[model samples]
Target: MTSAVTTDNSARPGYGQLLRTPGALGFVLPGFAARLPFGMLTISILLLVQHTTGSYGSAGIVAAVTGISMALSAPLMGILTDRFGQSAVLVPVVLAHAAAVGGLAALALADANVWFLALAAVPTGASVPQVGPMVRARWAARLEGSPLLPTAAAFESVTDEFTFVVGPVLATALCTGVHPAAGLVTEATLTLLGGLLFAARRASQPRTHAPSATGESRSFALSHPGLQVLILAFLGIGAVFGGMQVSLAAFSAEIGNPGANGLLYGVFAAGNMIAGIAMGAVAWKIGPRRRLILGYVGLTAAASVLWAANSVILLGALGLVVGLFIAPALITGYTMVEQLVPANARTEAFTWLTGSIAFGQAVAVILAGRLTDAHGSAYGFLVPMAATALALAVLLALRAKLAPKAPSRIVNASVSAPVSAAAPVSTSAGASAPGSEAAAGPRDRVNERGMGHRVPVTVD
Candidate 1:
């Protein structure tokens, strides 16, 4: 059986209709609030290190380490959350994360030796995962088939944009302001406050007595061919954006406009956020693979603008345009990942999906930093752009097999084995969307991880 969709019935919304029901509004706000701390933490790490250590080299290394910790932690945590429930697993990790960051702040400000500063980073860095993704995943399960989800996703994308865009600016302003310590303190406080609130929310938990027999089975993410392709795509996309983070900061600083880094990033997020909302209101029936190819192509074009731009304004404007594709690409990719995997291991699948981004980001930070240090930041954008082009070409060639051909695409292009409009689309072969009459009790399948006891893997 497929996951259930959450319906918000308060308002019968038309075009550009977002937050149709009170339930959706309820879900969306928590998702937004949950994201704030993590988003703030992401940029805060960069600013905090720079402010405390007084070295960009140190700052870059700390950021890279944080990425590594986050990548490592996300999948495992997601797996636990999937099986045991988010509250059972998420709360303690958040507590640990809060302690780590708060404790590290003391060390950082005390001018603890460089070694102590670096050492403290391990836990602090590992603490925050994209809480937004998990939050969105919950929303996905809650609001599956309803038109509300896409709109919810659109709002989620915008909130994410705000988080990344505004998060750093807010942190920077606070850190440099009268308090100077306010940034990290605020981040810590929110993580505690929000994480606790999330943990306490009854609706946040999935409605189930036991693991779906399918969910109870376990498997390694790598062996799944669809997951493999998704990971590769994630890595490439992650690399591109990761490079942008480092290169943008350095690029702005080089031009005697380091402060504009957040503004440019905000513009980039703005484009994606606005476009995401717009796309949400319509029917998006494109095959995941074709849409993916489109997204990569869009990114390539966006990067080209960056490589060719004459001014920061041009770069920011182009960034905004390119940003449009980011959310859609990611949303489509997550949907594909959910379809291909199984009833269990869904959380792990998403975790790896995110991990790929973090890994790519880490690699980008390390490699891009060195590249920027040697040549100008302008030269730094080349690698990720080329990588995106290559990744898109590969996915397109494999489109027919890994991703199902869309109903619309099959009609226009000759194809067999097309899923019809009336056909009940099973998550696997016979599964229907949640809240549908067609869905019945699930038949458990064998989930082999690498080949296990108590190994539950859902394709979410």
Candidate 2:
């Protein structure tokens, strides 16, 4: 049963084929637009703070605060979205996010206190919609049991890579060429427009019916073993990537071509994006664990080789190699998380996955920055190498924990009935047992928390 559930639709499809799926284009494109700001916001804030306060240190602090706030708030927002409808949750969040960005821009233009800028970043970061997670959940719900899901996951990674790849370059250009405020203002505008467009698409939203059982369920996602290890693995990978970014920039500057930093980063992203595209189009017999373990080893090997290269060309080549492994790791990790948690828990689970990566990157950037300053730029490579090695070690030691339980054995087993791929999975905590509920009717019955009866829990 587990094998059937996990491996349904074994035929591999072309990367572009997933777009032919109903609602695919609508979901992916606007998600790309809203996420453009995710790639741009931190850098924009960093530059804006530096320009206003005339201190790189102060700017770094402000950026860090914003990142941490976003990471912490993401899962909370995901939970809320799962409970309330997407439009109900998303519209208000986008409005608040836009207002926050506006405040940051105004303060920067006025040359306000650095602390004030930092304070404004708190809301700005907290208000960012968990678009990536929501969209991924939607895709999984839409394409349940199809071979196309892995492809969709791969395409999702590429879209993310595209935004990050281009976002920094675009932000830097707007801030430096047009005005400091231009970058952030643009970020806010796109975020609102893209977010609203996405929210309006009711067809793609996942359904969360009332759970027939509830008290036995755990609200926190980390309670499951599979999720625990997966989240840790994601954090480690993020640290390596983050440290690599800082190290590469420092190295480029050392080579007397600071301008080449974006290009170098682009080379790395291109490798990841290209590899992701190819991987999606092929059939994979291997499970997520094997791919994940191999990806860690490849990343570590690629990052270790960076210290030996003095030329930007060699570094770029090695960065590309490192990038090649990133997508597989991410695609597998996300797929595994989806399988491990209940449908109701997916939004928060996905957000936690993303947040872990962001947290890892934030910490990596700070530590790597100090390491480069103290030991020269070459030593910065050690940061990624060490982080990757740690990830490899943990995945190996905890391999058994990551092996997923059979679908029939999930905590809410009775509630795990298969539904049509076109319909959204009910994520409600109080959903009725699958067999009983399906016997009752095709439509799902979602119980709101305040309903007048004791919520029963679903168990395998």
Candidate 3:
């Protein structure tokens, strides 16, 4: 019976089961709306600053400054969320973000100095809510020991890709068809309203606990060598995003149809979303660590040819391929946090990964923008290829560090059974244990804190 159950694909829980978990929809809906601005803000800034300054270089600098600020501040915000709880940290942050966005838009429209615009960007980006990470933390808490954790990670990635699809299109349409500043205004509005609504879902927010007696709380997420590798790899992914955004816009402008930037970007993001959906649905036999390396290799391969795409159709097709390969890498990274970090630091860990992407994007945006301005949009494509290749090398060198430092043990409370640390947990249905890399699903088991409930625990 156990063998039959393990072999039967139908026994695995689907996305519907994951979503039906209590209080999931309450936060997921508002969380989706809040994060739309994540995709909008940078593009809107690039377009608006370019419109005002008449230089892609200048626009890129401002956008890059914003990305850098976000990268620097995200982990700090995560620490606050972990210490003070999500709603308490988010309410003030969102309010500040809205105000800063308004000020940045005003300065640009008023033809303020580039330095002033850049300075204003600091607060704007710093205060932008880390909605994506927060939401994922909530999922981590709600589905801690469940098999649905990987599905949740994939679902969040899909949500992110969907927003990217809609955000660029909306921002581009508003800026081109309505007014240059319209996109920024709309982005600010959504950030404020959606952020507040998402913050108000306190019932679903992860509980923030006080520090343990051992002073374990002082440990930062980056202290883990494995997490550092993941961050570096994600930075490369960020380069892909930054490279594509500027290059796509520059290409569209070069072709005498600037409005097409949104459409092209949308197609790229649609591929990512589709892949996320597929990744979540599959019961994978391969480990996430191996899957991550494979996904990134494919992404790097697809990115290598982006410089050769001269036509809109060709660029879009190449971009689609790049997008398809990115989702697995991203989902795997997020899923791996459960095994690498303690529950208390999971939120901060997620933010570190996110911040690395922002930092990478910032660097790429400036490089790509200058390259596009000097040579052409085609030259900007080199950033992602080089970045991914370099990151892949780092990942390969540190591949051994990606494994969990300690073996995971499952304690079954119903029967008071103690599973061997070196062996897989025996489920009645013979399903491979949640944390085991060999499981026919994504490995997402976290170190359970207590012994009362049946959970996987990893002792460091």
Candidate 4:
């Protein structure tokens, strides 16, 4: 149970170890299916509404509504899952989501009013399953107290990159090649099937915490100072994604290659996937705050180059550079949220991260669309640059507060905590490190099943 903050891939478990965890695949495969629609929905809706209504402005509004709804609902769903367990909540939510998608498709096909389409987005977005957060929570629960936890987190980041790479392309192909309605229909079908399969995997489900145990007067997870900073920072990152999508789409259309947007984005995801896999396998000595700052720097620097991209080839090449920091940033954030809050608030805390990104993206799309529509695609890149700059500033200002405190020495401690590569190992008094029983108070050490576990100390 020794810590490996400075260890390389040779010292860590192989990628296979992530799947070898009991019941890992049962949740992961369906989770992937459920998440695929995230990539599809925004672009598909953008194209579909724009095509039918004859205006990108109308399409952007509807899409923005959908994204905002999804973002707003994330924390609520997280609370629900934390209180009642995943299966109990997922069944109803997923079915309702499928139904909403069906209605949205029918309305789009019938040339319904633009406001009517926006109305449909409310339920469609609200019903998005807590799949991403759930999958991460499941991994944390299963791998609780294991040194391999960070490795698992990295694997999940890679999975996310892969989904983004394929999901948007799939959406675009369905909307363009097959039929406009095809993308929405496929999204609904996949979500339903995946949600059902995920629900059936009882073995992999994480333990649930009753909200009442925290007492009615307890502060929400976001009330914590560090978590607040992280959420705000993530908002900037989300804006980066949202603004880039709009810019790429407009740029493609301007270049007489509207369909190339998905491929360009895929190039972006490919770079992220490659970097994410390697990031997960290696161990780091630097703390999470430093890594987070570095990621911000890299993302901003690479994204700044987009303003100069006049051709699709240049955009594709720059996409790879912009993607390099995404995985490191995301993986580190997830790992930190796991340790920053109490065990009971784990799911809800993660959902806050999701919601932050959603809100940021929602704002970005709305702003970027108008910017691109008024000026040109070239101006659209400015939105992400501003967003990343703000993020970097936030991290720099809060670097000391956000960094984990050094861990305290213990006499013959039984458990070693797992450390995310993005975060440094805490060794000071009251330091909060992942899976550290000493760092977590008595109530925080208990599992969802009302059982307490001892800390597994590392020999090294």
Report every candidate's CA lDDT: 0.65, 0.76, 0.82, 0.76
Ranking by TM-score: 3, 2, 4, 1
Clash number by candidate, in order: 21, 16, 0, 20
The model with the greatest lDDT is 3
Model 3, runs deviating above 4 Å: 1-10, 212-216, 254-260, 409-460
Give the TM-scores of the predictions, in the order they appear: 0.80, 0.85, 0.86, 0.84
Off by over 4 Å in 4: 1-11, 211-219, 404-460
Q: Give the per-residue lDDT digits (tens) of candidate 4, residues 15-89.
A: 786787668888888888888877777778887888788887888888899999999999999988888899999
State the local distance difference test value for candidate 2: 0.76
Candidate closer to the true structure by TM-score (higher is better), 2 or 4: 2
List the RMSD of every prediction in angstroms: 8.7, 8.3, 5.4, 6.3
Clashing pairs in 3: none
| Better by lDDT, candidate 2 or 1 | 2
* lDDT winner, 3 or 4: 3
Name the candidate, 1 or 4, with the larger lDDT value: 4
Tens-digit per-residue lDDT, 211-322, candidate 3: 8786755556788988999999999999999899889988999999987887788888888998999988886656778888999999999999999998889988988999
lDDT of 2 by residue, 1-460 (tens): 5444333223236566688887788878887888888888888988888888898778877887887888899988878877776778889999999999999899888998889988988999899888999889898777654445677788888888888988888998999999987889989999999999989888888875344475544356767788888888888778876788788888988989988888888899998998888778766655667888888888888887877878888888988998998888888788776567777777788989998888888788888888888987788888788888888888999988886554332213323543324223334443535654322321111110111111221211
Where does candidate 2 have its weakest 10-residue lDDT segment?
444-453
After superposing candidate 1, which stretches have Cα over 4 Å from the reference? 1-18, 145-149, 207-216, 219-223, 404-460
